[model samples]
Target chain A: MKITAPISTPAEVEPLVRAGARELYCGVVPPDWIQRFNTSGVNRRVFGNLNGYADLERVVEKAHALDADVFLVLNAQQYGEQHLDALTEIGARFRSIGGNAAIVADISLIASLAANVPDLAIHVSSVATCRNVESARFFAGLGASRIILPRDVTVAEISAITTELPELEIEAFVLNDGCVFEEGTCHTVHLPMNKGGPICIDNYQFEYQSAGGGQPHERALRRLEQNDLDYKRWLWYRFGNGFSVAPNGYPWGPCGTCAMPAMHAAGVHSVKIAGREGASERKIKSVELVAQVLRRIEAGESEEKVREFAVGLRGAPGHCASGYMCYYPEVRSRAVVGEVEAKVEVPA
Target chain B: MTIPQSTPTLPAPPGPIELGFALVDERELAAFARHDRLTRDDYLDQLGDARDCVSLPENAEPTHFFLGSEFCEHLLPSVESIDRAVALCERWGLTFGLVTPIACDGLFEPLRAALARLPAGSEVTINDWGVARLVQREFPDLRPVAGRLLGKMLKDPRLPSATWARMYPNGLRAGPFREILDGLGIGRLELDFPPFGAADMYAGIDFPVGVRAPYGYIAKGRICKLGSLSLDTPEKFSPGHKCRRECLGFSEVGARPGTHELHTSQRGNTMYYRHAAGMATAVAEAVANGWVSRIVLSGA
Candidate 1:
């Protein structure tokens, strides 16, 4: 499997590529588009985008020199007519600059680019919500060469898609940045941090009003309180414990390193490191983490050993044990069972 | 009231407007029956009791019924329930429609089984492209309508309608999307009444448009907060986990004090906001002018 890392500047290209990223992706928000549409540009990010075509060209050139492919992100769920025209122009310019692919979500844009700019390989973004094999096939028919599976999809679903469509390249998320909502179907805007930030992460005080006519019993009320607590805890984990970093410098967030062996066996061609708008150091560390795990898998290490090594690198055994940081929690079930078996085999 | 002499009147479109009801279960039928009698504010602010019954106005009675869900596959009704809904619709002489959610691989078979239960020529609201492709390839007889979930718009409740309308005036209208919809045999496009007016956005579209009233969805996710309520901490917020359908009992309403007046309600995995009282005027005007073909009333 290959590691596809996010890079914004030409400088980030070399460090990310040297850190073991085989493919690089970034968003370019030109001044014109930003002026016309504000920071809610063609991509989901509000920051860390290359400001001009010249910068993007340099990014592509540098990555290509390092024997790595570069993809420009135009992956908004839907774009207006003006936005579409500008994006199509951007796609043509990227192709002219020798960019390898365009990661996109809108079907119209996908079909348009496939027909107009046939040379540019299209990678369907996870925001397209390709959870099923049929969705994968649909995008493939529309000329997408790669499908980035959404983060919420199970390992079994990923296996099913890879198994059904062996010809299409499949990418799965490995580390950092998990959304509480399905990114594709969510219509709420993520305004700038100055403008109260993403709606999903907004701290709103909740009041549970019963739909039933009569008042609920005390036990039922206690259950509802517990439900509220559980919901808040889940949100906290989903937001990466308010984006805290570990003492070992690894980011604490939704991770899928334990599922790497399963994903590799399932024919996932690449693993994606999310957070393109994040700092370059974090991006490099994420790529390094995935690269290390992939190297062990390549060396034919057992899945259990790889899981242990991945947990060790992440540096939070408690979070791993709780399965709160897992993108695929199913792996934890297997790991727990394995531990139980090993304990049983040991002499008392 | 003094009439504004400067207001330009547009000619009403020829043909009758169709009214429809979108219900999650039989329990919602009671609320929907009194839909026409309740004002927009009354419906938005005071409809807490699900069992409350009120009378419907004769002229405003619905002629169609849309069953099932557009967000959660787990919330999909059984095949028997679908058949019963269709039978009830038949008895009431109302047209029956099916709303399918953005489904995963596991839901494909069950959705197909449900689709098979529908009679020929029934309208099926498709929220996912995969579901659209599946219906087009398999159930050729059923007509597909692009659902509101598929219609991507700027739907922040905190923002004014004018801002959202200006930002996303034309949704799913650019590129070859209309042609693609045609290729899929979609006859109509379904949209929610945005806080902003719908007339400008609904204009110049090729197919007929259907608008859902009052509750406009802001966001949705696969990991349902209500479903997570019953699970332990380790399994909390896990996507596709089994649930007790806690959302059917109550919804969590939220407000950000000292920020915005927009209140959000979390029903199941989806977050929705009630549109302003005057927001429907533009949609009503659009309906009068032939831009909007139908108005669907949903009780959350």
Candidate 2:
């Protein structure tokens, strides 16, 4: 079982690289980051205004230097033709950088990328809503090399898929937060405005637009009636069936712990930790600790001894405990998703 | 009585051309009764008109006289229901088929299981992949009609733009319905349209006016009534309501009193007549032109 983690900063990434981290994944940079960081002002005309490529390139180069893999998340679900075109450009750059990063869930882009660039390995994003082995086989036939298994399946379902499709690599999300509504089943991403429900981050651009529209207090009420609002109305949500929102917030990312380790044990090509937006430090530590414990497991250490080692790595003071991945579930909680309480110490 | 020598031909190709009508409920069937639109007599009557044929359901038994030698689709709720349907069709000497929402699980399986009981030459239609996969695996004779909603295949972006010609010659393009139907391969392949909603935008006809049938009525967020269009029920079929039910998969909240609207945005507040008109035209054309052979009425 190969274990991988997400590391944002040079500080966090260096240790994990040496620790033999197998892979790393991260999100696109915020639009304002180029200006905010006193860099050349960013504009969409040159690079379509998406400036996150440099950061991704840097991470890929560094990780590659350490002989580790880097996965770029072009995982935004809602996009149009233009957005897909931009992705095609970005994907080309990703391939050019000697980056082996496979995109996460984002079907439209997958369709586009598959058509535009067939050589790029297609990792069926978790959100594509593949549920059964039949569906997984369909994706595999369609040239998907691996599938980020949905978070809601029983271990049996996972096992069955793995057994049924030996040629296909199965990746699972381990560290879970609250809620198991599963990725493909939840339409929270496509949920209509309920006037009463919390603002739907179902669409990140919509969330970004709403967030940037004004102050938080004002945006809250306006967002409830998002359909009525304009200006940022350019963004629209697609609510097709077979779409689900996981217990995690609107956009479901990976579980950082249990899933990655299990992926390793299951001989999943790579086990990935989910967080990338922030918590670079926690991301590094979590990956390192998880990898350490997995090494011991691979070494035939007693499950109990491995459990003790995990406790120290993932228990309180674990980087993930605070507000990095999910707000709920303490770092040391016994909940399956809270931390690998048995084998790995979850960092506070 | 002078027995007609030939069915009234719609003026076309030599072979018996297939003809079908959409139905959502029993009221629509009974409404056809009111107009003397179709009956057992019409069964023989239509024989001279067309050779190939299939008739959609009308909240009624498959043995109904209007459906003759051609296939009949019944919306069976369960495998048991499918068994009953198969038995009835055999007794009546009619071709049998099943129409079910993909969302319904139990309905498809039993129908597939009951396929063995069906006489040597019976047929089945499935809208969901599970049933289609199962039926195809179990019974090679199973004829699957890709449900309109389920057949909306995502354009495989990996395929070269040039390869689409080979992949989906009649694929529905990504624009309005005309493009969608044509670009998505749906137009090329035979499929059923959702009953009583929008139809192919390119169709240039309208449903026969003054046809009355029981319609599901929602008022003030609740189903206050259910009856025909002419019944003057308390609730009316708001275009907005219809749009929500058909496109958005939910009921629209707080639509303006006695008003209906459609817009590009699923939940947009701004009302656009163009969008509404487009949907209306598509619905009318599908019915008038036979692009849609069946209509599965809901809320009836």
Candidate 3:
């Protein structure tokens, strides 16, 4: 499977490509858009965009020269009519600069781009929430050449879609970044990180009460406590445990390295490393990790060995054992359930 | 006395605004039929009588019944349940509609089965684009309504009204977006009353709009942390795992206290907050202007 890495600058393009990214994706926010809409750009991210079309042109040129493709991100959930003309203009310019495709989320935007700029390939963003084969077929009908499966979709579901629609390219999230809620269905605004981050990760004091008023029974209280603990742990995992990197320099967050064999066998065309706004080093390390796993899968290594190597490289067997960091948790249930060695080993 | 004349009142719309009831399952449908109104016992308990339990206006009888969920595919009604809902709607002379969640591949067969049971003109409120495609291809006769989940807007309850107004001054008035919906055969778009107000949010939209009231969803996921409470750590956050439906019994209330004074409730895998006091007045104005064609009362 090809590795699709996130890039924020022309400088990032060469490093990510050298680190084994066959395809690169980035977002550009023009000064006018930021001045008008403020934080609400064409993408979910509020910051970390290329300076302007000049930067975009530079990034595209650099990627193309290095034998890699660049895709522009216009993947916000929805856009008003005021944004239509500017967005169309951006797409036309990106295509004119030899950009490979545009990653879009809004169906209206997709339809508009497909009709207005026919030559530019469209890859449906995961924010579109294309979970089922019918949804895939729906987007494909609208001129989408690729679909990025949401992080919540299971490996089995991913395989089902890829197997059914062999003609359409299917991409799955394989490394870095996770969301507490389904990114596509979540409607809360993500203010800048400094101004009180995403609402999903905000700390809140929770209290459990009976539906009919008054205190809950003892048994129910116990369960509620467990639920509370589980919820917090899940949140922490989703937030990448304070966004810390592993001792081996691998990024810590939701991962799907072990599922690569199954995803590849299922005909998934590419694997995406999320976190377009991440630091350059983090992005490089993330791409390097995925490239290493892809190399193993390409060499026809055993699934068990590839998983073991991936986990060891992550240097967190305990987190892996909990299955909290897995993008496809079923891989653990199927392959690592009875294997104690995989759970106990921690790379020094 | 003549100097204090009140503002002139505009003429009322031609007819009573269409009222609809959105239920999660067969039990809620039966309760609504028995009580003749929708009530959130949990929501009331949380507020401790500060607010009323009934979500609807006084003595308002609903003309439509919508069954199913907009966020969780696991909560999709069974074939038997759909049949009973349809029968109930027919018996009550109410329009029948089906609300579908963001479905996975495994849900397609069941979703199709449910869609097949609906009558020719039943409204199918879809949160998933895939379901829209399904209706367009196989069930062309069934009308598709763009459910509130698909209506992406900034809905941070913690933010003040002024912030929301500034953030989204004119909500969802995009021509191209509406045209796409029109092309997809969607007749009406479902919305939540924005934190600021509904007047500006509902402006300039040509299609009919349905506003779901009292509780607006903030965030939702497929993993269902509430449902997985009983499982061990290894299996806790797995998506699409079977569960005992713990969310049906009660909900968890959260408060930010001294921070932003944000209060939220967790029902199933989704978090929601009650709409502001101005929503009712805003809905009245929207309905009067003929922009909002329906008001669907939900217990979530």
Candidate 4:
């Protein structure tokens, strides 16, 4: 499987590629985009954006010299109609830099990049939430070359999509950036979190209130002062359903390298190591580790041996510890979804 | 009795727009009735406190109805429930919309076929792109509305309090995003009414948008509360294990640990948030200025 790693500046491309990155992805926020659209820009990440076209151009050149592909990210989940003009300019600059693809989440942007920049391959970001075969097909129909599956899907689901849509490249998570909730559909507002507030980590201290019968004093509904606030909220926290708080703090960036064998069998094209905002050393270590596992697995190592070795790389993603950080969490824990009942015929 | 040839259409009167409600199943509908069953004035006063109340006005003649789960197929309604929803909506002359969760390999065909059999022009809110494609390819007659789940707007109620300001889409040019959705035949955008950010700003966006009200939907999980509550072990409360569907019995609610405000509630697999003081006005302003075209109220 191709290992796609994040690069920060032009300097990161060579080392990452030599460190065993087959594909490189990066983003840029020009002066205009900053002045006009003051948010995080099209990159979704507040940090890790390339300073300008020159930096991006340098990264593409270095990566191309190593015969590696570079992808520019426009994967922000939301986009404004006013920014389309800027989006076009960004798309043009990315293509001019010899970037191989555009990783995108917004449907309009995917359509935009595909049509306006015809040659650039379209890779749907995990935020697009292609959790099902039909969703993958939807993106494929829109001319997407590859789709990065969400962090929450099962290996079996990945297997199904790869087998069903062989023409399209399917990528899944291998190392880092695990979300407590499914990424594509989550709306927890990460960037400007309150003091310890990004709900994913369960940091925000919450007050429980009764939602039934329109309780006049929701807060006064006898909180009972339970020691385990998490447990109490599980039973009584009724709204649409339940909250997804990252366990053990923000280390939700759990690795999934152990699933390499399954991903290979499933025909997943790439294994992603997240953290565009993370350190280059960390990125390189992740690439080297996953590459070691992939090389061994490819070189006729037993699946058992590889899984054991994968764990040796990091204690995370080992066996199903039922930890909140693990992606494809079912790989270790009894998945918290799929509640469909067994259909059995009862003899009358 | 004169049987009407066509179902009565629910157009917004010259006053406020007609509001609708979303329920996961009959149990939620019943839950809603228990609250609405109280004195109208009393219920209105306590609307924000109701377990399933989505900030809907009591005078709301819910002309449109979304009846199903939008995050997990495990939470998806049974066939019997679908039929019941159709009947209830038809009886009340409400536009029936089936809420679909994430697209699963096994559930797509069956869900598509089931939805196709509904009344022509029925609305189907889609969270997965594959399902969006399914509606375009197989059920063109059904209106495919991209609900808030699919919008993925990052909004947190605690944000404006702790930080300077969160970024929101202010406007857009006639860029590729609009043309692409247009090509796919998707004309509407459903948005979450975030706590502090834009509900949103799809300015120059040439499509009608809808908002999930008072309790704007925040995050969704593969973990489910229905089955979770049954187990004494929180870790054991996971997906795919045996479930009595316990979410039907009770829901969990809480406020931020140190503060009584920024409250969150869990119903099934989705989390809903009640906005802090005065933030509702900002969300309302977004809706008023056409950032959001309608308010979508649903049970988790």
Candidate 5:
């Protein structure tokens, strides 16, 4: 699997490419666009984009020099009619800057780009939420050359989609910013980080109530309920503990140096490392660490060795006990349940 | 007398537009069908049928039928299911719309097959652009409604305290986004009313809108918690073997004092907000402003 790293600045280009990234993707929020629509143009980055277009052009040019391709992200959920002209211009600039493709979320924008900027490859952002094969085929047919699968799907689902739609390239997240909710459909807005960002992960006012109710309702609960909760027992099992208990798997942490073998076997075209707004050190480390693991996997190292390496690199061993921080929760779950030393093949 | 001249009596505000409820399984549909009004008791039972949406309510005929899944692409009903829903809705003179989720690949052929069976002017809510393109191309007669997912409404659940009040009162939509929706051949758009207020945010967007009930869905997962929630060991409730349609049973979980709420419950392998709510007047006012045309009365 090829490593698809995030690039925000020209400085990140060389080190990331040298680290392991064969492909890089970046977002460009030009000042004019920002001044106009007041966002990175519907991007996932509500804090604002990491780089400007001129900087993006420099990043792309440098990545190209290193034989790595750069994609321009314009993957906001909506790009209004007024933004379309500016959007078309952005696409033109990216292509002119030698950006490999443009990752888009809106269908209208996808249609617009495909029609107006035929030369620029159009990739459907995971924000489009293309979960199934038909969805993949629909976008591939509609002109999106690639589908970046959402973080919620398992390796098996990814394999199924890639298997069915082999013509379109499939990319899946392998590192950074793991989501509790499926990204595209999640409507909860994040407050500015200083205000309390990474919102929804640890927000307050939410509560779950007992399912018990009226006589007939009570009767049905006794008869049909299998996973009923104990409201009286306040031992953390009440209305909805899915978030509080599991905390939605992991935070915007790492998922590097693991799941390589399964990802390769699953036939994923690319594995993305998500952190365009990351610190330079964090960004470089993520790319380098994934690259090291890839090298080991390429050398046919055991899954145990690769995992051990990753755990140490992620600093999970003696220091951390939170398995929720696991990169591949399936593998982690299997490791605990099956009592194996974490070298087994992940479920596909 | 001139000022009081009957104030041009505005057409009685269209009688709240016949709010339609969405069900996850046949049991809820049956309850809706059997009862004149779903009791609080009936609603509690309906919550248990988490992983599966109701097959057409053979008895209870909603004004507009949303006959499909919204979150899980895998849970999409068979083409046969769509065919049956379309036929039944047609017989009832009810408008049948396939409530599509944000999915692309696995649903194409099934949707197409179902569309072939649908009469002209049938609606397929487009949550994914790929679905939109397919509906535009192969299934020309089937109308596409830009789904709420496409609208990208900024939803922030409000707290009781005034500390966070400043974070909200935000607004969405403008001339350009509305034009884009129109460009997509979307005469209608599905909307989810936010916590604080939405009557004004959605004011100028002129497309006929279908507003989902008081509760807006915040976050959901592919592996539904209700689908595999184990009573014995909660930790074991990972996305294991999908439940045998036992999600009908609902449970309540909450934090003490000041806890930020994110209620989730599974409905046939997909999850919706378990405690989503909004005021009736907000929706009524939306209808008054022509911002709403249909009401998707969802699970409370």
Candidate 6:
């Protein structure tokens, strides 16, 4: 399995590459506004990307010299005129640098890169929601060299995909945070007239409504509902989508998680870490952690030990729930009932 | 407008309509391009192929490019820069809009300032309550759509059920839709419709594709529930400061990719629509079937 790590500053680039990360993905630039619809929820100020493309070019060059590939996330949905020209300029820079590839979702951006910078490879972003074999094929057919699978799929589902699309390279997340809502279901947001209704806050509004109006809704509903909240809980339990529940509620520190092995065992071509949002220290440490785990896996450690080491890196008490994968009731039942150490010491 | 003597549940519309996909800024476009690493050809192809535009017949669709916004805080950026960019689109005959004030602070201050400078009947989507409200209140001739879904959900979770039954003051709930209905603007709702392709892909994933899900290297699903959330939190229960855990963006059943079986081929699936085509189809169906006469398409 290929191990990928996130790097943000110039300082951590070396450690991540030394840590056995196959490719290094970083972002020095803010997400361009063209594709705001897809990622309007994330606060841009948090990542310090306000500097724009010049900063990104600097970061990419430094990362490349370390012999690591940089996948710049220019991934935002495009909507206006200035956005197109910005892309053209950015595309030219990407082509000049010989960077690994550009990851994106909007077809127009993809189309733009194809026209402006043919040398750069296009990788379909997970944000594009390529869960089915067809979506993967569509992107691959459109020249996407790699497709990232959604976080909630089980190994079984991934295996099913491999069976149909054998040659396609699959990238999965090993250690990083992921969302549980269905990516790309935003028609309701599209409605021009505000349908005088209510908005659910804690990710389970659909369940609240279908469960007989809240308490009764949870008790009376015989079958599951598809609201954002229910689907969130379902994914958490079924696919192990809940990786590192920060003891303090914030997703920070090494105790959070490192997921490369699970992704490797599941047969993903590349095991990537969620980047850009991470701090330089956390990013460096994350790379080291994954490298250590990869060495152990390559040394032929048992799958149990590998998983244990990965979870142990969390430095907190927790177990893998496979929430993002398929939710087989029996598997979930076994996992819920299984004994897990929750805290294992990372190898010195 | 008078209501019909009898109100019946309306059937979903049929057929897909063309979208004049537009957005708010250059940074957004650059970000999207970097995220996807789309090629110039890919950009042009979408513009050339985009036949169905969500535009007034005279208003052309932005050429197959991902449309972006010209909005800025407290200031209307010079149209010369925008004109230069739009000139590219006009050369290609692509229809894109220079949207302002969709999701911004001090909404109308910038919009009125910007609108005053644009041509009459220029195509633009506005989301500011003040602008929408003022458009209706002052400039009834100008059509501006409400950008946010304000009153549709409860702002305060602590409010009693009884309080919800009795509608709040018209302006109080106006945070989401007041700009549209108050005739301050176009009195139209602009849906930030999440694209369809990824939803189908997301629906095929087994886990919850929400922000609260665990972090890992694999990208399995999209965050569909963020901006389109419905008020479905438990009674007076607070999940604390974890924005990831709390803060449901909207109240709706977000798509579940976990249960849906993903077909390798786009042709064979009946249970789901073509990932990209579905959005267009939904809009066309809505219009052709008269579920709605028009809709403003804002990507996010």
lDDT, each prediction = 0.77, 0.38, 0.78, 0.65, 0.59, 0.41
- lDDT by residue (tens digit), candidate 3, A43-145: 7776778888899999998999999999999988777667777788889989999999999988778888898999999999988888889889889988999
Off by over 4 Å in 2: A4-21, A26-50, A74-89, A104-116, A176-182, A185-265, A285-289, A302-348, B1-78, B88-140, B145-294, B298-300
lDDT of 2 by residue, B1-300 (tens): 345443222222222223232332222233344332333334433222221122222222223221110011222333454455455445545455544433222233445555665554444433333444555566665444443323222221112233321221122332222322222222222332212234453233121111101111110111101101221111121111111211111111222223232111111211011112333344334444555333222221
Across residues B41-61, which tens digit of lDDT does each residue of candidate 6 receive? 333232222222221222212
Q: Which stretches in model 3 have alpha-carbon errors above 4 Å?
A: A35-40, A192-195, A333-348, B1-12, B33-60, B160-171, B259-263
lDDT of 6 by residue, A22-114 (tens): 686654443553264233311111252425556566657766777768776655422222254565466667668666787775544565666
User: In model 3, what are the clashing residue pairs, if there are any?
Assistant: A135-B130
What's the TM-score of each model vs. the native?
Answer: 0.91, 0.49, 0.91, 0.80, 0.73, 0.47
Q: Which candidate is the best by DockQ?
A: 3
Mind giving the per-residue lDDT tens digits that candidate 1 earns over B1-300? 222222122344556666676777545545545443433233323333221211112234356778888988887878887887777776666778999898889999999899999999888999988999999999999999999887887777766336544554344667478878988898899998666555566878888888886577888889887777778766778776787777888777768767665456788789887655445556656776677877677755
Better of 5 and 6 by TM-score: 5
lDDT value, candidate 5, whole model: 0.59
DockQ-based CAPRI category assigned to the predicted complex of candidate 3: medium
Fnat scores for every prediction: 0.71, 0.00, 0.72, 0.57, 0.40, 0.07
Query: Arrange candidates by DockQ, highest first: which order?
Result: 3, 1, 4, 5, 6, 2
Model 5: per-residue lDDT, tens digit, B41-95?
Answer: 2432333432122111112225666666566554555666666666655665567
Residue runs of model 1 more than 4 Å from their true location after superposition: A35-40, A213-216, A333-348, B1-13, B26-60, B160-170
> Whose lDDT is higher: candidate 3's or candidate 5's?
3
lDDT per residue (tens digit) for residues A272-334 in model 2: 455443344445545655566677878887544554455445343232222223211122233
Model 4, span A190-284: residue lDDT tens: 54334654465555443333335333253333332321343333322211013221232212235576678888877899998887877776677
Error of model 6, residue A199, in angstroms: 9.0
DockQ of each candidate, alpha-carbon based: 0.52, 0.04, 0.54, 0.35, 0.27, 0.05
Ten-residue region with minimum lDDT total, candidate 1 chain B: B49-58
What does candidate 4's lDDT look like per residue over B1-300, in tens digits?
A: 222222212223224544556676555554443332222232233243432333333234456777777766766776666776777666666788888878668787678667855788888887776777778888888888876676655555556452333464422334555565666677777766665554345545677777665567777877663455445443443444555654554566665666655567766666778765445555455555555556665443
